[model samples]
Target: MTSIAKQIERSYSATRASAKASRLVAYGIQPASRMVDALDTHSVHWRQWQMDVVETPLLEHFPEGQRDALVYLSADSDTTITQLEPGKIYIVGAIVDRNRHKGLCQRIATEHGIPTAKLPIGEHLHMLSRKVLTTNHGDGWR
Candidate 1:
């Protein structure tokens, strides 16, 4: 079966480990940034993984094939998906770290031989903030 791979592996930063832990907690409680709570309103079934997804990779877990449909999404990807398709798993990178673990998601997908697509962010007006949208914003589009 084809599935979506969200290459959301965040390399641990030992020097900033304490700060990251606290940052994660802040992300959970803050409604504007809380992804799970927002998704609950839409009834989207999802799970929150405590560990790096790379350890228990989804590509290894699920059956694979082009016929089944396994695609991943990332800002680093060149391909774009304007509309989501049925029977396709849309893996959203779940890294809460703001450092833009740059290309980490795309790298993982490439390692798994999973295709990738990025949101059409260029058509919109140029904003002052960084281009990449929050996970909440991406999920809301669906």
Candidate 2:
């Protein structure tokens, strides 16, 4: 998952982050203000997105009791996603850290009691490179 952390956000240049957010929006993904302030800053074509600016963090945006429905996708997670189940709000982090902060997302998810899962890439294909994927690539948008 590429969810934003101050460190991760700082790791990216503002323009690159904005461009990534734009791509997510292009793929119909709703971005949070904490990750990218494109809507508030009016830095991009805000009208092209089909979502309202989410001012709060995801955990607060949803009802407390619905926390179980939130799933954080982290490459470090032990669990692998075999299928896309309905009624689950899957969170894909938006940062590109280059592995400097390995297991950060999974740690965050564990601390918040949110379940975490890695993609089933290993089950389908073998690769010579690290398993980490870019936010857009992981989401099947690139």
Candidate 3:
């Protein structure tokens, strides 16, 4: 499960905070407004093998070069999700800026040369609104 507090948050606002909480609940996690640190190794999260994208002094979850990671489930991503790689870190960008910040994740991933993808939403649903989904919805949709 990839839910990085720092990588996804450009600025901390009440809207962002609420969206994060919703994502937490969607993942069956109780939302923590001020999660200072990542889950400990021996904590149940390690068993689940989680990682956060944002680099922070409080947490160093993923490795330096995330070659083993796959960032996906964006509204603007062109690549479609066809299969899941075993042991590959599949990270869904957590953004809730009300479309004011479009393609932010795509830009970041491209800057880092990280390949990005979106859920095969067209194949699954008739999009009435924007294709972007909250973190939890993306998590549960597949």
Task: Compute the lDDT for candidate 1.
Answer: 0.50
101 in model 3: Cα distance from truth in Å? 0.6
| Candidate 2 regions with alpha-carbon error over 4 angstroms | 1-43, 136-142
**Per-residue CA lDDT of candidate 1, range 18-131, in tens?**
342311111222233334345444323323533332333365555456425767778778898888787676665555324657778789888778888887877663656545
Task: Single out the weakest 10-residue window by summed lDDT for candidate 1.
Answer: 1-10
Task: Summarize candidate 3's per-residue lDDT along 8-99 as a digit string, tens digits.
Answer: 33122222344333221112233342333333311333323222223332113433465546464466778887776665555555545256
Q: Mind giving the per-residue lDDT tens digits that candidate 2 earns over 27-101? A: 223566333554334334444444344545666676557787778888888898898777677776654535687
TM-score of each: 0.50, 0.62, 0.51
Cα lDDT for residue 55, candidate 2: 46
lDDT of 2: 0.58
Error of 1 at 4 (Å): 18
Clashes of each: 4, 5, 1
On TM-score, the stronger of 2 and 3 is 2
Question: How far does residue 72 in candidate 2 sit from its true spot (Å)?
Answer: 0.4
TM-score of 3: 0.51
Clashing pairs in 2: 1-73, 1-93, 2-93, 2-94, 3-93
Best by lDDT: 2
